[model samples]
Each structure stands twice: as structure tokens, then as C-alpha cells.
Target: MKAARSDRGSQTRKLLLFTAERLFAEYGVEGVSNRQVSEAAGQSNNFAVGYHVGSKEDLVVAIVRRHAESIERRSAEMVARLPAVPALRDWVSCLVRPAVEHLASLGVPSWYARFIAQAMTHPTYRKLVFDEAFASRSFRHCHEGMFRLVPQLPEEVRRERDDMGRLMLVHMCAERERALQEGTASPRSTWESTATGLVDALVGLWLAPVTGPR
Candidate 1:
């Protein structure tokens, strides 16, 4: 009986969190309300949000965490498919390919990444979601994966590449918002945005061959 009750509770929490995520994504963070979340999740009680989710910020953070975990899991799975001794080119795609393919298939807007940046740097609510929703272990695993892939780059170089990856992610996210407003949808948001291609460009830029975009 206890096990059954626990499973039921877990299912309920999952339902609530999933509903909250969809609502927040469709409606901007400021526009969605907790009661609406509860209603959207199909719960009968208006007080369900207060009882189940602690705060509006908590709800937003929970949504962000969910997306983060999904992305990380996809990333790990994709990385696991790479060659045992990955080159810098392989390493770069391993870090980025999963995100582009997976999110694209799910019809997810890169706006979520923008949402994450805004959440992470928000004066009022920064770190609320990042610390709580994402497991520290996931970030650790990602760092390890990158280290394995970029075995040749000095630590400083790797860090610079990582920063570049972040810039690309942020750029993708910001551009997505514009694309949505402009209704310019495409399989590839921008030309030459492939993870593998991006890695090649970055590697060349870092090495000074000057073969591609900086």
C-alpha cells in the first residue's frame, strides 16, 4: 500500500511539472499563473499550486530544470555514440549536436535556452532554477565528456572553446526569438549552423588557419 501511494504521488508531481512547463513555454513567464498551471495540469483544486509547488519562481525553476535534464540526457546519449578517441572536431559536435537535433525534432524553440540565460542572470531570480532543478552531477559529467573529447587542447583553450560554445548557444537562443517574431522557420535556423561545421570553424579559428568564420 505504501509503495502504491508513493508511485501515485510521483505520478502526480510529474503531471504537474509537465503541465507547468508547457504553460510557461507557450505563455511568457510573467504571464502564467499558478492556478492556471494547476488547471492546465487537470487538478481540480485551485490551491494545488500552493500546496504542491512552493512559489511561482519555484514553478519556473522546476520547468527550467526539467528542460536542462532532458538536454543533458540527450547530450550524453549522443556523446556515447562518438568514436572512442574523438578529435577536436568530434569533441565539438559531441558537445553540441545532441541539442540541435533533439530540440529540433521536438519542435522546441531555442527560446527556451534564452529563457535559461535570462533565468540564470536575472537579478531577482537568477540561480533559483539552475541550482535546484539541474543536478550538479550532470554538469560534472558534461565537463568530463568535454575533457575526454578535447584531449589535445590546453585547459585554457578548452575553457575558451567552452565559452565559444556558450556564445553560440546564446546566439542561437536570441536569434530564435527573432525568428519566431519574423515567422522565419527552417530546418536549420541559420545557414552553416551545424554542430560539426561549427566545431570545424572554431578549431580553425583557434589554430589560426583562418579557413572559416570567426
Candidate 2:
């Protein structure tokens, strides 16, 4: 009886999370609250807080874990396709391309990456940096590769290089959202062009010789 009840409860929580995930992706994470999530999720009572997944923060953490793991898996496959001895540019591109491609998926909610990036600066949710990839090797792999490719880059510059991929994702999301707005914005469904532009910008950032004066 207990195990069956536990399983059913877990299922309900997961459904609520999935609902919250899509909502967060569509509407800004900050714009949505627990009541809204519960109401939107069609759950009864305060089941989302400390009952199943702790607080909304924990739910956000859960959402990040799911998406980041998918990204990591996709990145691993792309990395496997690289040359035997991949260069810095190759590694960095591998790190970013999966995210760019995945964002193009219908599964991802609107402005998801932008909201994730914004979480980087948010005091309450900044731990997402670690969850996103800071402590992970796939991320560290690219960081080390940058040093190998551009050996002269200082520590500060190297740090910037490490985060460049996420930055690109954020910029792409923001640009696309802006382009999607009415009146002032143009109807640029030209995503291929925008993605190409993002790749070019990334390569330029990494390949630019960083040895000159600060």
C-alpha cells in the first residue's frame, strides 16, 4: 500500500514539474510563482513545497538537472564525432553546437536559455552555475582545450572563454525573442541565418589573438 502510494505521488509530482518546466520556458521564471505553478499544474494543496520536491527552488533545480543532462548527453555524442586530436576551436564548437541545435527543438520552451542565463546572475538561483556544468568534466574539458589552443590567454580571459558558449546561447535567445516581438521587430523566421551568425561570433571570440595589451 505504501510503495504504491509513493509511486503514485511521485508520478503526480513529476507531472507538476513538467507542467512548471513548460510554463517557465514560455513565461519568464521570475514572472511565475508557486501558486501559479500549482494552479497551472492542477495539483491540490501545497504539494510542490518541501512535500515532494522541496521548494520552487528545488523544482527549478530539478528542471535544470533534466535539461542540463540532455545537453551533456548531446555534447558527448558531438564530441565523439571530433577528430582524434581535437583542437581548441573543435572542442569549443562541440560544446556549443549541441545547445544551439537543441534550442531549435520544439521541446524547449521559449526563452529558456535566456532565463537560464539570467539565473547565472540571480542571487537566489546562482547555484545553477554548478548544476549547469561548472563542476562537470565535459565543461572542464573545453576549458582545458581553450588553454591548449590559445596558450597565451590569461586566467581572466580563459574564464571568459569558458563561459562564451552559454553567453552565445543567451544572446541567441534574446535576439530571437526580440525579433519575435511586434511593431518594431521584423519577422525574422530566419533562424538558420541567426544560428550561423552565432557560430561566427563564437569562432571570432575564441580565435582572436588574446596576447595584446588588456
Candidate 3:
């Protein structure tokens, strides 16, 4: 039946995605090829990735979109609970928690955090993936709220802090994820605690006093 075929197609697509994420995470984005992804995914057809996901860039974006929906919804919910005038920490929490929360929901040994960290390292894919996140209305809402609460900052300082905050979040989660996967002890006992520590650090980063370049 049509429904049966549809179900099979969906299954194949999901398998391709799972295989690609793990491989891409282990190997860098540029290190992995479309044929390898399909082959590792156990597809008989070497062109399976090309057929199902088009280009590698398309695959990366698709993977980001898959996870972005959950993070976006959680962000929207957090935003909805905000007061008329929210604290800096509140807006920062909205940005930080949804991501860690989604990772928590995946249980242990999830590949997404590291996958994202690796994606952000590549020049072309970094902008591609981040642009995908920035396109989310919920992400934009959280940013607008966060920026409004902070002290008026020069454009350069704001840009600097933005990069700092991003690296902090991505690398922190990636480190925690690596620890969890290896069964090594983490600095924090749980994802919730990790997120709490991250929010604290980000608050300091965002609110830190800036000096002009000489």
C-alpha cells in the first residue's frame, strides 16, 4: 500500500540521518563523503544519500532542522513565561536551557552536541548551520529579550560577546557529551547542573565590562 511505502521511505531517511550524524561527528564534515554515509548506513545504493538528502550541505541543514524544532518549541515556552521586564539571567536561561534540555531528553551518548560543535568548526558549514538556527522565530525572540536587558554595548563589544557566548555554550555541551559517552566523570552531576553553571558563566560574559581597543 502507499502508506507502507511511505513508512519504509521514512525509515530509510531516518537511518541515513542517524548514520550521517555519527560519521560526521566522528569524522569532520569535510572528512566524510556522501557515498560513505550511504554505505555506512547499510544502503545497497551508494547514491542513497544523494537521492534522499541531496548535497552534504543539505544533509547538515536537515539534521539541524530535525533538532531545531524541539529546541525552538522549548524556547517559545520559556519566552511565554517571561515577565514584562525580564532579568538578563532569565533571557540567558531561555537560550541555554532549551539546548541542554533537549540533550538531556536524548538520554546518554547522544551525538548531536559534538556533531554541532564539529559543524561550527568548518568555515562554510559554520555559517550555514548557525544561519539555520538564527532563522528560528523562537531563537530570535529569546535574543531580542536578552539584548534588551543588557547594558548598552558598542557594536564591536556586542559582536565579541556574542562569539564568546556561542563558543562557551557549544564547547561546554560538547565536553559534557564526550564525558558522558566515555563514562568519565563530569564536573556537574547532571545536565541540569551543567546548564545552571553555563547560564552563570554566560551572564558574567554578557554583563562583563568592556574596554575600547587601543
Instruction: Indicate which candidate wins on lDDT.
Output: 3
- Per-residue lDDT for 92-190 in model 1, tens only? 565556555555554534345545555555555555754643344544555565566443665666677666766665556546644754688734544
Q: Model 3 TM-score?
A: 0.96
lDDT of 2 at 7: 96
Q: Rate the local accuracy (lDDT) of all candidates.
A: 0.62, 0.66, 0.90
- Poorest 10 consecutive residues of model 1 by lDDT? 205-214
Q: Which consecutive 10 residues in model 2 have the weakest lDDT in total?
A: 181-190
Candidate 3 residue pairs in backbone clash? none
- Sorted by lDDT (best first), the order is 3, 2, 1
Best model per TM-score = 3
Where does model 2 exceed 4 Å of error?
1-11, 22-31, 107-111, 161-165, 177-195, 209-214
Comparison by TM-score, 1 against 3, better one: 3
What TM-score goes with each of the models? Answer: 0.60, 0.75, 0.96
| Each prediction's RMSD to truth | 5.8, 3.8, 1.3
lDDT tens readout by residue for model 3, 72-174: 9998898899888889999999999999999999887798988998999999899888988766898888888899988999998899899999988988998
